[model samples]
Target: MIKLKAQDAGLSIAELTRRSVLLKPLPKRLSKITLATYRELVRIGSNINQLTRATNTAIKMGLRPPADPEQLEQLRNLLQQIGRELSQIETEITDDDDIESDGDSEDWE
Candidate 1:
């Protein structure tokens, strides 16, 4: 019998011990779409942070920051698009769970 070491299997000791009994597999890797969404989120976050810092600096200098209506609209549209994409992804995940549960029930019979 071949012994499987945690380190050899590229898993932590705790994860190996815990999962060994239950025999549950690890979660799947992030899909490309999910990764791209996260990257977009980070980019948007950085842009907002830069805007905030600029606004703060202007306030400290007693100068009013000029706002461009077009930029604001673009940010608003980007946010809305992200929200829609997240909702769609969430729906897909929920649907997958439902299908898995249905299949599990058939296995019991």
Candidate 2:
């Protein structure tokens, strides 16, 4: 008994039901990261935390940079990796949040 404009191209009740059924398991699988990537992410995060703490303590004590230039570069690369992984995590979380919110709103409608 519901009507929609042709331009809207909205789902029919049956189509909606079908789509809802298909989407039922999406939230459960959402925001999943591969185990290897997740492990790397954790390692990078730990490195960032440790480096940040050391940097902060050094700054408080007015310490100088390391004599080894390669170590500094390695730290920079690790931090960059951490940043990239965190960005990926944020995107996945946002996408999953959108999917879950859409499902909830559809329920009300």
Candidate 3:
């Protein structure tokens, strides 16, 4: 149908597409959850930083950390989990790019 319209209007498909783009805006390009996951990662990283600072402060001042050995082990586990999640997000983003370039790349014309 677009080809027909472009032919009838005596305009190349590329020209029609260019004019349409000038008249309207493209939608978001990130079609994935990577962005949200990144934001969550930032928040988690900040919390972990604060926890580390507090623990260090307590130790420096000759007080036991509120978080003992067991708690520290749990924190380590949480960090490992977060690392795995980050790796997964990275893989997903890479896969999304691969998918777009997987013989589907096309010129608008």
Candidate 4:
């Protein structure tokens, strides 16, 4: 029997156990392409965040003008690249979803 402490709240231990038993477990592995894309997304996101913070700090400290042309150009390029990559990823996901839906419909026929 499953046991829950008082802090668990709402569901009883038995109910929780029953619900868990009915749920499917997660897959253990992802395709290498998926993993690589996810990692690239993370890396780009982190770089953008760090660059934004650094730019903000520089502005606040009056260390550099808010509109330093070179810095602004670099920031704009980075942002554009991020936007392009995100759009590509979104297209890929939409294509995959369409494929899955087509397969599902076939199963019913």
What tens-digit string does per-residue lDDT give for candidate 4 at 6-80?
113235656555556776332222334545666876777677667667777887887874445467568668756
Q: Global lDDT for candidate 3?
A: 0.61
TM-score list, all predictions: 0.47, 0.35, 0.43, 0.38
Task: Judging by TM-score, tell me the better candidate of 1 and 2.
Answer: 1
lDDT of each: 0.58, 0.52, 0.61, 0.52
Judged by TM-score, which candidate is best? 1
Q: Native-vs-model 4 lDDT? A: 0.52
* Per-residue lDDT of candidate 1, residues 1-109 (tens digit): 1133454345677876777767776434333456567788878867766776776677678888655545755775787788678756754553234432333222100
User: Candidate 1: worst 10 consecutive residues by lDDT?
Assistant: 100-109
Clashes of each: 0, 0, 0, 0
**Tens digit per residue, CA lDDT, model 2, 1-101:** 23331112255656645555676322222233443456776787687667666766776788963334456567768767876776666655633355333
For each candidate, C-alpha RMSD in Å? 8.3, 12.2, 11.0, 10.7
Candidate 3 residue lDDT tens string, 1-109: 6785465345787866776678643222332355566677778777766777788789899998856646766776886787687666565453336443445343233
Task: Look at candidate 3 and tell me the lDDT of residue 19.
Answer: 64
TM accuracy, model 1: 0.47
Instruction: In model 1, state the lDDT of residue 54.
Output: 78
